[model samples]
Target: MATADPRLRSRAQQQQPAPVAPPPPPPPPAETTPAMGLDGSGDAPESSGTSSDDSFKLKFCTVCASNQNRSMEAHLQLATAQLPTISFGTGSLVRLPGPTINQPNVYNFNSTTYEAIHKELADQNTQLYTQNGLLNMIGRNLNIKKYPERFQDWMPGKPRLDHKGDQGYHGTESGVVDVIFTCEERCFDAVLEDLHNKGGRMNRPVHVLNVDIKDNHEEARVGGQAILDLALSLNNAASEERKARGETGWDRGSGGARQGFDEKVPEIVAAWQERWPTLPALWSLAWF
Candidate 1:
């Protein structure tokens, strides 16, 4: 009520916080929807496609040198896990290295039965394989599945004929797999080379991965478990991506084929590698 001093009044006015500027009008409600004129619609554009569970169903192939040891072990493991898979040998010819370097046992993958090989090995010198555990390995292989096969025979080009002039097995010809897991470094190189030479000829893309594993029973078992874990992780990631993209079941190539291996596969691979860091193992992925 009393007249305040001019300096005091000026100081009071200066201390009143300068009106706070009203927070810049709440940023215009963030646009809600993108510009409609560019795409010709204000409504969110409907997804061009959708994915189904079946679309996410992946086919797998496993490869090793002879297809009787490492690859077969992985094949049985994948089957036990209920994932569709096939196994193949990357050797120029299907044969097993015997006790001594000179005593090699050769067989045709498509026609030879594990039973026959086991019998032959057991008869040659029961003490040979029996001492080194080859006999038991062959025995276990016999009960797992059908006869072993070769990877060259699975190529998309002309049929690989045996000396008897018979067409090679066409198990893989029925459909191309989404992924191939090779058990050793040599097999891995063989698969990638084959794919590079023939993949462009095929209509679909394939992802080939290598998990360097020793060619022994124990190593195969360890490798098989690793492969199964990686596979399940991949399948789940694919399904989740499809769902996120609004895909449904068996959508038949809707949702646009996945972009390469997607971001999750590398992370999963790294974790898997870390799990077995000391095993002289390597994991690599290639597209074809």
Candidate 2:
């Protein structure tokens, strides 16, 4: 039994109601041993006050239309937690709103750096960009990474360049990511289609999820926090499975926490969705 009596706690303090049978298991996510981690005889799993967030970090990738606001916000959040993360844009070219709506500023996703974009925009018309929040958005992007990366141009198993000496996530260095989150449905579609076109050259499985976030600062902040929470929840689940299976890393040739973690994704996301109802989420398994 828990140290504190369940009856004494108020209803608000009680655990939230279990989610309604998770949306058809988005691809047969497994029903783990049970929420308690208890056996048939009803013995609860061992307890620990320490968090598992930093114990094992999942390699993540965040994607958005132009990788300016939402994705970068999520990148910042994951990096802030010291999680291994990379980010990208799904657009053909990076686009930012210019002084006039028709004359949007466009840049080469591969050649332009966030710093360069920030400086140019600041010099062109500081007040306009600042008032429109473009400068502020790119300013944050500059702090998180060097430039906007195109998901279409990403080559699996190839490490990131300019990773060192940046205020980015310097956790485990690997070009591959375990999960890919897109900030919009169209971007998610682009990612899925792109992955289909690539056809798994790396032979590594990855999860692609979409969380619809409006292109705005306030919404991005809320979505970023939600993404971080989801990341932590996922890491916690994977860490538990790792402990149960005596595994050390994510992949081990057809055996490891990866399988269990994949199986539980539906339930985990479902629980997370219950909290952030306004932000709709989508999930699917793909390869890199």
Candidate 3:
């Protein structure tokens, strides 16, 4: 037989070993799936990054136009839900007041039966003026009668430290920010401008949660529940894995005021603040 060419034989043997196909590209990174946090809700995660201001730990901030119905409900829900990798707050440092309660001849602060409400908002500098027209407007815009049980249970009767453990807007970003959120389109734009001017989060991701404002108290309550559920889902997504593995440092105190809801709320809020860093203007709505 003719002597086979060594180079050609070697090449043929190598090729014959088996046409091993190149490993397929890694599924294109799974498309990032909308940043849904812990709660299983589709709510996007806030940005995470080092802030220009090293002193503060807010590499991100959530911007909302007014700390009233929609935004305040989101704040409370996020606080209670314990979202991970993110913090929550209104755009400006001003505190927000809860909705107005029914009263008679409430001209000044003391004259009003809802003085605690006043103080609650006062602490945060949230001034909400509820006229008779606003009530009608709330009735038209929201369905308060939907979730009465939840309203009675979670709604803060009187806004107190509701700060979820003495926490307030530090007014600076000095932490890792995963994203920023806004409650309303307007607020989102304003925050965008601020970020653009300050080069916010060194060009991080941002989300907008556009929601309608409610004049009716009960409708706002329903909306609050929706927000709470969404917040819980998002929060759960980030921390559930860690919590399931017996992780601590997220306000797991044994007893005291934090025995139940009190302790859990602040812990969740703090955790969220640390992770999300920034929020846009919009309501946290959950689908399915």
Q: In terms of TM-score, which candidate is strongest? A: 2
Candidate 2 per-residue lDDT over residues 27-93, each given as its tens digit: 2112211111101122212222223344866678999988888898787666666667888998889
- Residues 1-288 of candidate 1: C-alpha lDDT, one tens digit per residue: 111222222211100212222211111111223112111233422222222324455667888988877777666555444455667897867778675699688888778877778777776667666656666666556555446777767754343333221111223334456668888667766766655555455444455677878776567766766777767667666666766665542223224335533445667667767876754444444333
- Highest-scoring model, lDDT: 2
* lDDT, each prediction: 0.57, 0.69, 0.30
Candidate numbers sorted by TM-score from highest down:
2, 1, 3
User: What's the lDDT for residue 162 in model 1?
Assistant: 35
TM-scores of all predicted structures:
0.67, 0.79, 0.34
Candidate 2's C-alpha lDDT? 0.69
Which portions of model 3 show Cα errors greater than 4 Å?
1-63, 84-181, 201-203, 239-288
Q: Which whole-number lDDT from 0 to 100 does residue 2 have in model 1? A: 15
lDDT of 1: 0.57
Model 3 scores a C-alpha lDDT of 0.30
